[model samples]
Target chain A: MDLAAVVVYEILYTIAFLALISAGLAVVFGMMRVVNLAHGEFVLLGGYAAIVSHNTLGINIFVSMLVVAPLAVAVFGVVAERLIIRFLYGRLINTMLATWGLSLAMIGAFTLIFGPTTTSIKAPIGGFAVGDYSLSGYTIFIIASAVGVVLLIFGVLKYTRAGLIARGAMQSADMASAFGYDTSKVYMVTFAAGSALSGLAGGVLAPLVGIGPTAGLLYIAKAFITVISGGASVVSGLIASSGFFGIVSQAVTFATNSVIGEIGLLVAAVILLRLLPTGISGRFFRDRL
Target chain B: MTLNRRQFVQGASAAGALATVPSVAMGADSIKFGSILDTSGIFEAYGKPMEKAHILALEEINAAGGLLGRKVEMIPYDTQSNMALYTQYARRMTRRDKVDVVHGGILSASREAIRPSLRKAKTLYFYNTTYEGGVCDRNVFCVGTTPAQQSAILVPEAIKRWGKKIYVLAADYNYGQITTNWIKFYAKQAGGEVIQADYFPLNVSDFGSTIAKIQKAKPDMICAVLVGAAHLSFYRQWAAAGMKKKIPIATTTMSSGNEHKILTPSEGDGIIVCQSFSPQADFPSNKAFLAAWKKRFGHTNDIHEIAASSYDGVRLWAEGVKKAGTLDRMKVIEALESGIGYTGPTGKVTIDGKTHHVTHDMHLIEVKNQTLTIAKSYSQIPPSDTQRVCNLEKNPNDTKQYEIKI
Candidate 1:
């Protein structure tokens, strides 16, 4: 029974892991339709920011992750938007090319500054035993943070004025502009928020996994798969897709090993994409978001 | 402007001599030592120091009046941790540049990728990295300690100190796969048993389920054959789960890179490891090498086992060249096969001519507060694992890597 509990916890943790990593891309690519190929690098940047602040400046680890990492990446996102991304708006291929270049450049910069080895911070929380298995307390924190981030994204998008304006601007920019709202500013803030969310994921995961310059490659594919597999509506699609992929991957993983489990995930993605041409949200939450 | 045939022939002959002079004369007059390493990407942490060690050894050889009375020239290439580029660069070094001897290849995969090409080109190749044993190429000298040198000592010592039930966590590759066999071999020899052995790919960072599985199995200790930067997470994750207190860990793959220094003391402390070289080893040869490296590089922070092995490899090759008194490949191989030995940073390192592998004084060390402390020293552990399968003297044409099959 304890083994079963641990398995269930692991499944939930995997789901949370997917949701956290995909949330940023969901905002930028799903809602904004920006096609950010460098979303992974942005996460890497956030990881470095948190690590640098925590280790060098002696800031608290949580503060570094929660406050410094996201804020730093958000600032980077704003500058990136103004300098490069602003011009490539609406040009999908161009944005991809530009962001791909940006990712490479960010990786280079990271390698130059941080060196090749991974910089790791100690996990703040300790472990607790449930029956026969002793599980990492950090897992619970990650799941909680993932839930909080999703609800926060949902709340801001659905219940707030800025969220409403941002959604309207994304849906119909010229119409929103005619109604006396600035679409460009909204897009910029949304992109910044997206970058910030990526940073948060990176920061939260810093302790669980060490972050190197090229560490972003590990997450980029999985994040893109989750976000794209979710399709149009950002929050609903993210939650639903995270739920589906996370459960599938973890189930296979528990049944066998990680290698086959990863194969199972890609296979499931192929089958899922074939069946629901849109996504889970495209079918179920089509009218909600 | 109509030139006669004889005049044109004379002009062509002059150009031909000039073309031949650079390739033939340069090869004859200087020792071209080619080095290929991943100096930029993820493997740079290992590669940079190895590169520096190569430079340092070449510099020392040149200072000592060169090898065979000719100046040693180093031709270095950074493969940037790409596997395809390793073969590409190896070809360029061997064919285009025509380097006499080549050293460098960190991963076993990288070694295999370039080993065939180097053999085809007749370039003397040296792969100076710790790996699973049984590479029996006559033309190549693997300078790093293997599973025989590491697991033979580490597994038994761990069993003696910790307990008999061992849980194995290893990277999913040839190195990890074969090393796990050696660990099992040694564990059984010591009247111990492996409860569970898990294989994780180099890219797999999360060890949540694996850790739980290990705990459920209720192993007394863990034998971690994890590799690269990504696998460093196992230590962090293990510590985070408070497994550090519950169960101890021993590793054969901890110190080849900067993974030990990368982890915090809380995360890295009390892990048992067996390596051939450590900066903490107090020996004259080691001290001199460290001094020279510090002088050249301004810090000894980047020094690791592979780097030390690389330094030893270069010096060992130079010894063979000195004994043979020629830049000829076969002659040097014969001289090195006569069992050349050198006192290096890791102490007396001898070439096991039969297997074309190194014999080293393996150190049993423990990671305490992010630094390695030598607990006990074992001298001159031969590549017994490779020797069991590979006998180059009996079969000189042997070029196969014999994996240990249980």
Candidate 2:
């Protein structure tokens, strides 16, 4: 019974892990249609912000991770959107190339500033025992934060006026502009919000992993896989695909090892995409926000 | 003759190309020392310190006097932690630069990639990092401590202190695979058994499920051969789960990149490790090396096991050149094979003639409060693992790296 409970907890943690890493990319690529090749670098910037602020400037770890990291990276997003992303919006191939170059530049800049070695801070929380096993208390915090972030995104998009304008703009920018909504301004704000979400994910995960200049490369593929597998509906697709991939990967991990577990995830994503053509939410949750 | 625009351009380009042939043909008075390492990517934690060691050794040698009465010219190429660059730069160093001796390659794959080219080019090579054993080639000299020198001492000691059942977690590559086999061999030799051996790809960072599985297995001790920044999380996650106190831990690759400093005390404390060198040893040579390093680099914290070996590698090669009294490749190899010894940062390092590998000291260490505490030291341990399969004295033409099977 204790073993079963531990497995379930691991499966849920995996789901939360996928959902958190994919949230920002879902907004940027799924909603905004930007195909941000620099999304991983944005996440890395958030991690660095948290580490630098906490270790050097003596900021509280929580405030540094949750508040300063997102705010600082969001401002960087605004500048990046204004300078480069705005020019290549309609051209898909150009956006990919430009953002790819931007990613390289960010890695170089980070190496210059922080050096190439890995740096990290200690996890704020400790472990608590459950039956025969002790689990990291930080894992529970990550799972809860992932749920809260998803609901917040849903609430804003479903209920607020900015959410309505953003949705309408995404559906038909010409029509929304004709209604005097300033669609370009809407895009700018939306991109900033997406960047903020990625920053938050990075900040939250910094303690659990090592932070380095190339650390961004580690998560970019996993995030892209989860976001693409999630399909067009930001929240529901993310939840469904995260649930599916997380369960498959963790179950395999329990059975075998991490290498095969990761392989299981990639295999499931390929099969799911081949079967549904779009994604899980594309077929099932067709109208979900 | 009046030339057309295309003919004129072609003639000018041909002249430009023909003008650069003299430098390659005419050898300079200085002996070129070619170095290739990954100084700026994910592997920089290891590569950067090794590069610094090379420079320091060269400066010290030149300060005393040039090797073979000629100045040593360093020709460095940064591979940027990419494997493809290894071949490209190796070719350039041998064919274009025509260096006299080459020294670099951090990973085993990188060493294998360029070993053949250097051997064919007749340029002497020195690989200076602790790695899995069983590399046999007469053209190359491996100066790092091999698995036998380390795990042979570490495993039995850990088993006696802890218990018989061991769990092995290793990075999933040639290094990790071979090292895990060595651990198993040593464990069995000590009348112990390995309960489970898990291999993780170098990039797999999450260890929650692995930790839970380990708790369930409940081994007497955990042997971690995990590598790189990503694998460092295993220690953090293990500690976060409160398993550090429950089970004793032993490692073979922890402080190779100075990971003990990167990890907090709560995460890294109480883990036992064995390696060829550490900055905290109590030897006079080690103290002098640390003082010299502080004087030159302004800090002594970055001097890890491999960096010390790298510095020793350069000085040992210089000793060979001095003994040979010539820059000829065969003469220098013969000199090195004559069993030249040096007392460097690591105590009493000497070249084993038959295996073309080094014999050096290994230490047992424990991490506490982000510093290594040296508990015990074993002097002049040999590359016995490689020596078993490789004997250059018997078969000088042997170029095959025998994969040792248990």
Find the 10 residues in a row with the least total lDDT in model 1 chain A.
Answer: A280-289
Candidate 1 stretches greater than 4 Å from native? B1-28
For model 1 chain B, the run of ten residues with the poorest summed lDDT: B19-28
By summed lDDT, the worst window of 10 consecutive residues in model 2 chain A runs over A210-219
State, as a TM-score between 0 and 1, how close model 2 is to the true structure.
0.95
Per-candidate DockQ values are 0.79, 0.73
Give the CA lDDT, 0 to 100, for residue B161 in model 2. 97
In model 2, what are the clashing residue pairs, if there are any? Answer: none
Task: Give the alpha-carbon lDDT of every model.
Answer: 0.90, 0.90
Candidate 2, A1-289: lDDT as tens digits? 8889889999999999888888989888989889899998998898899999999999999999899888888999999999999888878999999999999999999888988777888889898888999888888888997998899889889999998898889889999999999888999999999999999888888888868888888889989999888899999999999999999999999999888999999999899999988888999999887
- Candidate achieving the largest DockQ: 1
Candidate 1, after superposition: displacement of residue B262 in Å? 0.5
**Where does candidate 1 clash, by residue pair?**
none
